[model samples]
Target: MLSLFTIISFVSIRLAMQHLTSLFKCQVFTALVCLLLMGLPGQSYAGKILVYPVDGSHWLNMNILLLELHKHGHELTVVRSSNSWYVPEQTKHYTSITIPTSHASNLEDPEYMAAFLKRNIEIRSRDRSLSSFVALQQQTLTLLMEAHNASAHMVRDILHNKELVKSLKNARYDMMLTDPGFAGGVVLGRYLELPMVFNVRWITNSEGHFAIAPSPLSYIPTIGSHVSDKMTFVNKLKNLLHYSIGQYIDHGITRPLYQGVISEFIDPNTNIYSLMQGADLWLMRVDFVFEFPRPTMPNVVYMGGFHCKPSKPLPPGLEEFMQSSGEHGVVIMSLGTLLGSLESEISEIIAAAFARLPQKVIWRHLGERPSAVGSNTLLVDWLPQNDLLGHPKTRAFVTHGGTNGIYEAIYHGVPMLGLPLIFDQFDNMVRLTSRGVAKVLEVTALDVDTFTQALRDILDKEKPYRENIRRMSQLHHDQPMKPLDTAIFWLEFVMRHKGAAHLRTESYKMPWYAYHNVDVLAFLLGSITAVALLFLLTCRGLCRVACRKRPRDKKTKDKVQ
Candidate 1:
């Protein structure tokens, strides 16, 4: 009787354990469902998304977000200019709308763009004086205006295209994704009566900050200023001056152009500020690690590394070249898309530097092959950039400091040797150098010896650079979701919530002085001045009373005597 009782007890215990295991598994599955549901509140709903990228680089940056949206059952359409970098095949889920743009016609020749940039760089390098800086600023503004005009012309063409207009009217896109760099998106959004979201490819510019959020010049460095958040007194003054004068100049030049474009399609009387300020959200491609700490609005999302992906297997030739380096490892060099080819002199210097290095080199060169190429160097017209960066054998990256390239290098934990040439490149290099993960070499002053030494310094200090990058990589990856995933989630959130108007800061509506509390300062100053004047008047009245009484008292005393 005792044995039989014991056996029954054992069987009951085993059955109970099996039941508990099933319950745990059920709970786990339910929790996953809750998480996914939390990320996407209205998963069942979808909306049409219209995207207009500013250039090829901007288009590429938008690809991941577009793909994720498509995967979630949203309809996507992209408008491309004739010079658009994105091919139809690359954007699998996007309907391509090709339009003839005047900018495209003028910039169709890659060589022309390259030469134009080269000339500008040469001019600025020739004279680094204040006058040269002003000239460069003017040159930059002129180029920007030309680009804006091109964009406006494209918009006019689109509006005039009868078939396209008919199709757009029928489609009824839910939201418009645009690059704030191009004002045409503003016109389109107004015409369509859709909320606009900006996918800012670079650091947030003054216009963006002024319109979408408040970025204090005191803490937030102006774009291309090459200063950090913590500024010296001189730097602070310089930064303030740059922001003030730069905004005045930019607005003066672009306002008319923006008005011109808006007049054609929307109400001519509509304030350009209203159109520019209509952005519902701004998805900036910057990370806190790469940028200095500053106040950011809820509507401004940092979607840095949105273009990063898991490393794929390298091509056979590329793999072979990397493997050939063995213990020495390989170095990847590229100047990004804009300056595809380098001047022969610059190329020779780079090639000669690579020849002296123990590490094998993969140089992305579009120009004539440099005669200085060594056996260890492989010159290719194009490279699998991200893939090569992710390779275990890659030692260091020699880059032109494009934002995309910098992010990729950081994402892959590869140190950089920055050869900054123009625009934001210098600023990017400054950030990298400040972080101790890279060194900068001026393109204008680059020689074989200097280039080689820069490379060597990066290589010699590999341990610390790698360690710093590793820390940044960890921080960058330590997020609730991947950058691309976060971008898509917010995008869908905006759609479901019918625009993120609540997230926008009141600062956007504030005047420049009001936003910065300059009005408050003025009020305080006026109050102090009034008080000071009152005190002065009081003192003067007391002095007159004392003098008059003393004379009267003296006269009375003489009379008594």
Candidate 2:
């Protein structure tokens, strides 16, 4: 009986041991499979990203970009202020940080900045009078200073924030993309040692195509450069003067303050514009259709059409209204962000212009109803601009020449009647006009008669401008990839390569004079001066030697001998 019991116990123990060993092996195999899957790039390499918008609510372009990027599986962190009107409802997808921007907006008061700059320039230029030169100098200084301050504050805040900084340290980003309007993005990008990219709201004609700095005077004032198609001598001088003054302000005041504040959080090596200089990519939100042909930097990528992704379904009475306009086509009218036809006179003039047009007009009038709007015209506070422009029935656009408006029209292959108001709108219209894709009508020159005639001529039988629009449409779409796809491809490409060092060539790799195109003139001037000095020295030596050892003249020969 004892032997039988021992045999039973041993068999039971052996069976239990075998089952335990099989379970252990299965668990190990499962863990190894998980590790292998996670090791793959598509699973493990999703990175952290931060997007900073200066005017977050008004940043329609950047907002659309955020949507597109979110769709790509990026973990985005948006840092905006409380005053910003547009808030994303879905915070689950993004890590939204709402910072108080009282300091930010206060830093941008135009009058205070302008006055401070005026005083500074008055002290520097020794001109008490508020002349146009002084005015220009003051305005330029104000813009630069505002930009400098905003950037400094933003950088300091981000780097000093215990949570933000800690997050950055723990979870390094793959890239930083921003609108140039945000000062801190460039600064923070540098601090975090990530690749930086810029999205310009305005297109460039002379002010280095599409990368937003201060608005170039040639474009701002609507003045064409007679000297160089890119920039006039005066424009170049203005840019230089602005840059010098700005650098002085930054180095003298802004940098020290920023460095002191930021040192407590980040490394001391961060300089103003350090991130911008270190950027691996710069994608401009400028479409070729809006800007005139000019010099372009290799780092600059035009991606204006990327954000033209349309919103939801069209509102009531839009489709039928467009259909009733006729088989020929319809015209859409909108004055962009800043300017509005709120004033009675401007509204009346616009109303009269639309009334005279035979084509149906969809006008975005933000103010009170005009006493006289034609049966063919429909007025709304806002319109689905991209959707409307993309419609086959849409023909010509009457606009204030905002970059967004220009790109939408171009993307839809519609011609324009640009009535530019302020800022780079004037330059945008000029480029569109020069390209023959659009005609420009000055806002100051607007009247019922001229506006109507211009609209008629564009929609008329000649159709020269329509052909231009078609050509540009083809060029815009003929790219190897869509603008959004291209941007995403490059962004991911940079991340995969751990920041594209090959793309970040030092601006000074070519000599300074060569970079600025001053080498030829510098060499010529240097050569001429050297030759002149040699000639003068030779003449002086010859004169002295002749006096000392020349054959005596007839009058003085006997005396010399």
TM-score of each: 0.82, 0.71
Q: Write the per-residue lDDT of candidate 1 for residues 471-504, one digit (tens) a residue.
A: 8888888888888877887888778777888877
Residues 358-383 of candidate 2: C-alpha lDDT, one tens digit per residue: 78999888658898788888988778
Worst 10-residue lDDT window for candidate 1 reads 201-210
> Model 2 lDDT vs. the true structure?
0.66
Clashes of each: 0, 0
Q: Model 1: residues >4 Å from true position, as ranges?
A: 1-43, 82-91, 101-109, 159-167, 201-210, 263-273, 461-463, 510-561
lDDT values for all models = 0.79, 0.66
**Global CA lDDT computed for model 1:** 0.79
